[model samples]
Each structure stands twice: as structure tokens, then as C-alpha cells.
Target chain A: MQVHVEVLNFYARQMRLLDALDVEGYAGTFTEDGVTDHAHRGERVEGRAALIAGAKLALPRYAGAAVRHWNDHYLIEEVDENTLAVSYCSLVTRTDADGNVTFEPTFAIEDVLVRLDGELYTRSRTIHRDRPAAAA
Target chain B: MQVHVEVLNFYARQMRLLDALDVEGYAGTFTEDGVTDHAHRGERVEGRAALIAGAKLALPRYAGAAVRHWNDHYLIEEVDENTLAVSYCSLVTRTDADGNVTFEPTFAIEDVLVRLDGELYTRSRTIHRDRPAAAA
Candidate 1:
């Protein structure tokens, strides 16, 4: 029970750091060799530095807009003794000054987090959007 | 241990049935009122009967082509005592007559499976592909 809460808190903390534009802190949640797979666009960023760089480029698209990622319906699978597979439907919303949606609101993310010592750090992250592909 | 194997087999059998064009058999894996959300296309098919209908419409697109669905990196989460959430990367490949690749290979799927009467059946399944959105 405590472990579950801690894990959920870890996820929330990562999102909160991003919301606060704490890129470095966000990147700290990953291991030194973490990987990010932007599956929605077929791009993979390897290593912690690359993952942080990718986030730096992507997270600021809504510079003047408010971006909120709502995640729920999480499935947490302990793939092995140490690795965890987590999935959730993340509704990412970007709103303007007038409260109008600035971008698509349906987003999802799946991740493989590994336990290092007693702490959990992400190993690989996959992203998705609930929209049609630009190309078939 | 037994439970894990059953869940994994559940996924494998569904793919096998699809590979064999056994829509009916594949549909049987779902509960009576299951929901399938193809997040890539922003479409949802509800209920076993409707799911079968949808599969019938989509599976034949590979009639003259060979389709292989490679699923791995599974993350399974037990949402509650009775409900389980499973996440995995499903790479689907379609080969032409000359055995050349025809479609994108990286596909991701997340599913909610429920335990009923000691057996597992999928309650909801969501799919996403890492690519730009096509004009809907």
C-alpha cells in the first residue's frame, strides 16, 4: 500500500515538475541511461541528457498557453521483480486566455520504470495521442 | 504464476485469432460489454458483437498480405481486486507478395481486463500509434 502511494506520488511529482517548467528536476526522475520513445511520432531519445533535451524542446510549445496533463486509468504491471510497466490515459489540454482549447486534449503515456536501490526511475517512456495519423 | 501465464496467453490468443482471421474467436476474449478504443483513429467500438463487426471490416485489409503482430514489453496493472490493466508495445507488420514491409511497425496497446468467475476477459482496450494525425 505504501509502495503504491509512493509510485503514484512519483508520477504526480514528475508531472508537477513539468507543469512548473522544472526541466532539470523532471529529468532527475529518470536514470542516467533513461530512454524516451515518442511513439506518436516515431522518435526515440536515448539517455537522460537526450530525454531532457527532447523535453525541453517539446514542453515549451505552449509558451503562453496553459498545459495540463490529466492522467488516470493507470495500469501498473510489475513486469519482473524490479521492472514496472505503467500505462495511463493522459488528457493533455492547452488552454488560451479565453479558456479555449489550443490543441488536441487526448494524450496517453506508457512507461517502464525500474527500481534502482529503493527508488524508482523511469527506464523507457512511450507516448501516444488519441487522434488519427497524418498519414495512413 | 498461473495468473500471469493466463493473462499473457489471453493476449497471445487474441493475436493468434486475428492472424487466422478468426474474428469470432477473437471477440470471445472480450466481456459481453467490452469497449475498444482505437486511439489512433479516434474511434471506439463497444460490445462484443460490435467489436466482431469492426474486426471483420478491418482484418480483411491484409487479405492478400501477411500480417504479423509482435507484442512485448508488457506492463500489467491490477486496477482493483477484480480489474486489471495491461500495457504493451504491439508492432504490427504487413508484408507484400515479395515479403517487403508495407506499414509502420510500432503500435501500442493498453487494455483493461476483468476477472469474472476466476477467468480473465478484456473489458476495454485502447490502441495508439506513434505518428502524426491524419485529417479526420
Candidate 2:
């Protein structure tokens, strides 16, 4: 089956916006009433305003840090015209102040994606199967 | 606008199989030519035999570990009849030998799902936004 390149590009753009901490671009990835759950803070920021505000707050804390993340072992269990459910593993890395690089453990992430207004937006997500310190 | 429950159910079953260490049920999630990257082991297991073998090896090591994984903040960027790209975050917990539980930092997972031979499987993944304990 042929995969849609547009879908891949959309996801890639979202990643780039996040990596660059582009607050505006980041907020653009969602709908007007989109919701975000920053699990680390145990907080869920809803709607575009809150999402943008949260990203603005986060950009500075990670000012000097560079991040690298990738997903492998993806299983596209099902698909339809408007929605999709996807599961995959993610590996992440962060660079510290002392120039020491660290890798976060790998984990499983499952998501439900919905097409709204001719754009792709996240509806819900579930993250599981994390093995921390795998790089340590 | 409508979400496919079967896809979610499939993901739930996959996780349940992993939690229970049910190799048979776990392996059923992949295709015959499926390949898995054992990040902890730093290797890739391809084909059904290797996939099963790798699972057998790792399941025992995680015997007593308790895990609960859920994805929230789903961004389904694009979904066609057979292909999809999704991004989401994950939270994970692990119980140690001492019975102490630790929550690893959250991670963002990006996946591309493809339909093949009447089954949906993952084609590629890119992980981003991994927050480690030090940064958290």
C-alpha cells in the first residue's frame, strides 16, 4: 500500500516546530479548542490560548537544550477515511548545560488522530511501556 | 468525525499481551515479515521467528514489573483510507524489586501507520520531546 507523503510531512512539521520551540507554529498544530497534556507537569492545557501559553513557558527552560526523538516498530493497526489509531516506540535524547548528552529510555506511545477542517489534529494519546535509563 | 473502536481495542489487546507476557498474543500484532528494534539490547529482530525469540528473552526480565500506559493529547494529522500519521505523549511507571514505584518522564511519539494485506502495521516512527528526570 502506498503511504501518503502529506501525512508524513504534517507530522514532521509538527516535530520541527516543537524542536525549534516555535510557539506560534506549535499552537498552529491544533484546533481552536485543542487540548494538551504535559504529563511531566501533570497538567493539561486546553484550548489554543492555554496551549500557546504553556509552550511559551516551556521554550525558555529548554533554551539551550537540543532534543532528538524517533519512533520505530510502528504498527498501524487500523485506518479509515477520517481517523487512525497508531502505536509505536520512541527514543529520546537531550543535551545538558555541561555539554553532556543523555538519552531518555524508550517507551511505547499510542495515539488517535482525527482529520478536522482539512488538517490533522490530535484527539487523544496514551503512552505506556517505558524503560527509563536504558541509555545509562 | 467517527473513531474506530476496533483500532483502539487492537492497541489495548497488544498492551495487555505485553503486560501479561503473552508471547503468542503479542506476536500476533505484527506481520509475518515484521521487524522490531530492541532498543535496550541495541538490536533489531526481523521476521516472525526472531521477533518471537526476542520477546521470549525480554519477557522474563520484566516479569514482576507493573506498567500502565495511556496516550492523551492525540494529534491525528492526516488519515486516508490506508495511511495515517499521528503524534502523542506517553507516561510510564515501573516497580522495582524493592516494590518502590518510579514514574519516568513523559515522551512524544510519532508514528506512521499503513494498511497491508487487510492489516494495519507501522511503517515508520519519529520520537520527539522526551523529558528526562534531570530536566524534569
Error of 2 at B66 (Å): 9.8
Which portions of model 1 show Cα errors greater than 4 Å?
A: A1-117, A120-136, B1-3, B132-136
Q: What is the lDDT of residue B83 in candidate 2?
A: 75
lDDT tens string, model 2, B51-113?
A: 778777776555555554545566665478877666667665565434344555676766666
Candidate 1 residues A1-136, lDDT tens each? 4455556657766765654567789888888988888787889888878877777787646565455455677788889878889988775545444434433557788899998888888898888868776895
Provide the global lDDT of candidate 1 against the true structure: 0.73
Best candidate according to TM-score: 1
**Top-DockQ structure, candidate number:** 2
iRMS of each prediction: 12.6, 10.6
lDDT (Cα atoms) of all candidates against the true structure: 0.73, 0.60
